[model samples]
Target chain A: MWAFDTIFVMEGMKMGEFKFISTLASVKASEVILDALFVIAIGVIVVFIALILLTAIFWLFGKFMQQGQKTSVFEEKGVNNDTSSEPHILPEIPVAEAGISEEVVAVISAAVAAMSADGKRYTVRRVRRVVNRPVWAAAGIAESTRPF
Target chain B: MNSLLQAIVDIWNESGFVRLFTLGTGNNLWERIASGGIGNLIMLGIACILLYLAIKKQFEPLLLLPIAFGMLLVNLPLGEVMKSQFNTLVPLTEQEYANYLKGIFDQSYPVFEMNGQYYWQHFETGGLLWYLYQGVKFGIYPPLIFLGIGAMTDFGPLIANPKSFLLGAAAQLGIFATFFGAAALGLTGISDLTFSSQEAASIAIIGGADGPTAIWLTSKLAPHLLGPIAVAAYSYMALVPIIQPPIMRALTTKKERSVVMQQLRPVSKTEKIMFPIFVTLIVVLLLPSAAPLVGMLMLGNLFRESGVVERISKTAQNELMNIITIFIGVTVGATANAATFLQPKTILIIILGLIAFSVGTAGGVLFGKLMYFFTGGKVNPLIGSAGVSAVPMAARVSQKVGQQENPANFLLMHAMGPNVAGVIGSAVAAGVLLTLFQ
Candidate 1:
């Protein structure tokens, strides 16, 4: 029985040795260089492939998102276009033959008087409409090109 | 007077000072060196030097301080903070059992019979560090650290410019190159200098220039080399500003460095939210082994971008990150006990780590030059060096170098694209290595 047990233990030890050799330990000096090269080529290639795939996916995703933003911006412009297409209604301000109306001048002077601080009397200045980009378009540009 | 003198003599005999000066008897020089106190003294000195670097030089001090203190704690004689636990079987007689029933013997250990004999199973308690080390041993802490990093990072720049992903991939050249270099070192026929494939993989990851990723991969591939590898990774990462510039200058022309690229397009909030989800799906599908690190990172990023979990994101970034950093730092440092770390292999690892960092930086810059050529001088090659995933530090180096050439140039946001992309790239490379080696 003791002899049988000793043989059993020896077999177990031999099996363990075999397992160890089959693993990393089995790579001989000659094969180490080849193995390292194999790992480098495969590792670099795999990493590049993975990242490149990500680049393609995200690039497409960016395009899709940009298209969506453009569509939204156009929709906003459509709303502004609808408002602009409506009939223009000029405000009721009586116009003189050449100069400004007296009623408008009186209203402007009263407005200036309402804005006076320290209770000092102030003169009415001329008012003019400045031509600029529409509010919606300017807002869209600012939203799209906001810097970091 | 006689009793006092006797007490003093007894105390002196029991003191660690006595143990420190004692020489160990062994059959061989290596064995004697390990068993004696001199090795521990040398380790203590090394620990002190690291402490000086961490404190005075501010070299990644948040983690380095705890790691150095842990090393100091472990090397002190009689401080069994990291001792291993084991169970022993003691053969017990029937009479001893009866005495135990009568409370004559201690009953803390249970008595049991195996075969024809009765034995007591005595369990020994392990040290404190041994318990805390389970997080690293089970590969838990690094992923959690990734989670915090994800929460803190903004992937907007990367989303705006996807080509940066290629630069990220290119920077990993150092990792593979060093793998071959380390394995080829074995051809020199120096027995101690040779490395197995796993050791080579672990050392090569130092080129990734990511501390948590390096730790995560090392713990899996080569746990024994964790101490030196972690130290080398963090040291090189801290030295990124110094190491990357010259390589960037050497690899690119003055005009290429001066190229001021157009600003990156604004990334929408919805795109930012979808990015983490899609990246997680694709990366995990490609390499399931990387799921832990990459998944946790995405989850943390999701927590930030989803904007619904502000509380949880804050906790992951602040409290949870700080706690894990402490646990990982100290435990990883404790692994550098003298017997394992005092080998020639460690010095080699340190040198190879520097080479890996330099090569990785050069690869990124070279790839940047390639992009500059292909794009008809639209791309600034300096930003390519930021692809090594040292994060904002690498990006800042790009910005600083570009400013030196053209003060009007701002590459911080642009370089951030590749900087963050490098994080994902290294994690992917880590997954590939784990697949091959693990």
Candidate 2:
């Protein structure tokens, strides 16, 4: 609301008192040129970010048509061996299910293993780390969890 | 009666104004015309028309009503009606006033010793409008208005569909087109009333249907032309309903306007929270010149978004906006005092203003149709026309027109996407112009 008072105070003193302060006032042109460069840079960034947003939008629309494919994939899984029968195995889900790359999955898996290195069969910290996993993947994992 | 006449003669011996008007102020009609007695009456007639447009037509009544009245007030000879007194708290002196107008000169004034110490004083003019005009002049009011605008605006829709940014950019086409129009008029050698690339560009921005940006930019680059530019900008903004629908109807077929857009998804609270911060950070970092306006707007949005600073957010929306609007209006009105405003270029500015607004609407709507073609009838082309930032007015026009084509179409929510986007578009166009000019 009140940004002008600084200009007033700076004006009240001559050079010596405001020696350090006057640099900003002196570099007005530089400030303006810097402003333009900054805007261009930001525009480039916003454009890329907007593309990311649009991808998310398109991804949302894709979810509707993929429902049938999702059910069939689960059906196919029922005929195959249950990966979870091997207690040490963590089943691999498609990238679409988790919205992450395989590399991101490995990094997450390593982090969880380190977090549970005390050798507890299952750890609460490990569970919380996996909670934000996509709903489809979470459902797939939940289908056969044995109640304690 | 004879004694009363004699008393009047005695009182008028000091000043002949009353007696002169009583005896008919001038012999010839032309002489009275030269005296501005007729000019004031003409100005009154103009003010009356403006009042009608504001009240009966409801074209930006909040500003137009006061501005029209202010016009009538200031036009009267030394009107006691609008004394334009300073706030009771601020004190100023003539020496202070003179010293301030000497600003550029003051920079080089002198380093002088007073009792073995040196001091320098900055120049600042305390002229009534010049002082307040400082805010208008250096691009201050736009952002302050933007702050109010930000608080009042709910970015939920834009956040819901972030891709609406395309519509906003599309609407800015009018700014570029008006530049050519202004240049063409300038080339015709019209009445020493030529627009510089800067001035013409600034004046043409009134078509964007954004008032504060138009005023802020015009005051900076073309301070002389601000009166007409501001009035035209606000007037057309108010006229969004009246002006835009014809082009919309003429351009679209019944099938086109009636195209029903799907219902907008409900945006999450978290999405709304991230939007202002994200958009502001991106826009301001890119366009720091736009930062003043974009920054303040984001600040106000942050207040609303964080869901914590409700009071400040409310104040920014209501009290702050109202106060600055009043100041923006009155000072703008004061600048229209006869000497500055009574000119041929003023009329030219008004004519160009209409052109700018019409062209802007055309551009936005036409682009919407193009998008509709690409989207295979999913997008209602009528909403495209409402991309002028007259806010709900333009949005409502889209809805009404679409309803005429198909009563059940219900494009209001969709039209709002572009309506709000137009605000950003005009602001960005204004930024581009400011960047060029500065």
Candidate 3:
């Protein structure tokens, strides 16, 4: 444990006052231990306190932002709900007929789910293969766009 | 023929080779050693090894290569690449006039009258490296580097999960713990091993795991220890992937490591823009001593997030960053010339640095376990080790280690929160140390 008296003595001292006990040779072993402990306590406590304050501030900020986002989402949903009169229909594509594996369809659906905001689930309506570009061009595009 | 022979001898005597081998007109082995030739040879050897590491091993080559080259340049005998410039007042006399006429002194040397006495102000120019080193010495380059880092860094992760800030703060345990370790080592009472509190603080900052912060704090607190401390700090940073994993794995079980954290909520554009500004105001208001490093970093981040200063942000992260990196690297390396570097204390500093890094990693992971326990294992303890700020490297290490346990786990973004938070934490820690010591 750190000695309170040492910290009190240090508190009253101004800058450069610690120069006297800067080196261990000038002070007793117990005093050096106490000084070092005091430093450790203060340093760790201050860092934690500062970061905790930041955490609290940002947590509140995050909550506020989330609330704003929720409000906007609700407002957008209200308008959409009021305007839509027709029944929504999904043209379910048969995986075997479309020449796509069940796993591939599931993967595509999962990707769509991942990208969806508000966690709204949507059924996969169809799957189409558009042969618009050569394989080399596709490879080049993939190569160029790959994340670092 | 005799005159020509004498001229050839004069040229030989004036050459760096003569200075390398002989001392005060003596050419004995003892004289050569006494003349600092042997020390320079050792330094050159060390520089070559560093060069090999930078080139072949690819250990932080961008900075290490320049640093090694600077070391090589400064250690060359009679190179005077780091020598200081000085002006001397020489009394104008008949002999002095004769010497000047004979070109012994530069003909351009200015002559002036001082106290009714005529004098020549003979200016001796400083070394090239000495001028460049002033950027590092005066605390200029580190903050500039931080500006570039700020521009590149995405604090969105940190902002999205603010609790990661605690892990960041926890990672700084290494620094203060090392401070205690350093001070405790002083209790050994060995004459060569004793370190002052200032020296301990400088050495302890290596635990911050941020090179710029380490250099900034060391330059301010213990300029003499800058060489070894910078070398140790960067070396340890490069070793993060290797040094961190063992500690990370040891601290957390496979189950804890595999615990996949939920993806962070998407931060709004307004929130992203406000993050840096809010951080700057709070951090600077609390610790004004951190203003230079933290303020510049936040400014750079604002440049990036604001999306208005695209050109300036690009320059900060790319071109300006490169130039300052070269200058800071070479000049800081140049400081490691024979006298200051080849000491027992340097070894202790390196050892203490490793301890600081290890302790910091352990501290972050342990704190993460506490979070995991409190949150009922929702927080993967593996991401805690990323709290030591080595940027994406430490975070990537967390991801890699976690993936080893469970391939589906993606902790990179989650780990990034603490990773960047570690940067802020270290800067704040550096400020606290500076306030206490400086």
- After superposing candidate 3 on the true structure, give the runs of residues whose Cα lies further than 4 Å from its correct spot: A1-8, A11-26, A82-148, B1-14, B18-35, B92-113, B118-120
Q: What is the C-alpha lDDT profile of model 3 across B1-438, one tens digit per residue?
A: 999999999998987666555333235554445346666677778899989988998888888888888888887878888998899998999887778668787658787778867689888899999999999989999999999999999999998999999999999999999998887886676756878778899999999999999999999989999888988998888899999999998888888998988878888888889888888888898888999999999999999999887879989999999999999999988988866776789899999999999999999999999999999999999888999998888999999999999887889999999999999999999998998877
lDDT of 1 by residue, A72-116 (tens): 999999998999878878676533333456777678778888876
Candidates sorted by DockQ, descending order? 3, 1, 2
lDDT of 1 at B304: 96
RMSD each, Å: 11.3, 17.0, 6.3
Ten contiguous residues with the weakest lDDT in model 1 chain B: B17-26
DockQ of each: 0.27, 0.03, 0.34
Query: How would you order the candidates by TM-score, starting with the best?
Result: 3, 1, 2
Better of 1 and 2 by TM-score: 1
Poorest stretch of ten by lDDT in candidate 2 chain B:
B16-25
lDDT of 2 by residue, B1-438 (tens): 999999988877644233223211345664444345455566667778988988998878888887787676666654434343343222224564456557533455343445644444434434454456567766777789888888888776666555565665556666666665665553344534656656776777887788887887787777877777888888888777788899888877778887878767766566667667766666665455566766777777777778777778888999999988877876676566554565666777888888878887887788788888998888787777666787878889989988887776777878887787677666666666666554
Best-matching candidate per DockQ? 3
Give a tens-digit lDDT track for model 1, residues B1-438.
999999999999887766666555577776566566766777788899989999999999988888888888888777888888889998877798778768788768888878977789988888889888989999999999999999999999999999999999999999999988887886676767878767888999999999999999999989999999999998999899999999999988899999989878999999999999999999999889889999999999999999988879989999999999999999999998877887889999999999999999999999999999999999999989999999889999999999999887889999999999999999998998888777
DockQ: the better of candidates 2 and 3:
3
Q: What value of lDDT does candidate 2 attain over all alpha carbons?
A: 0.66
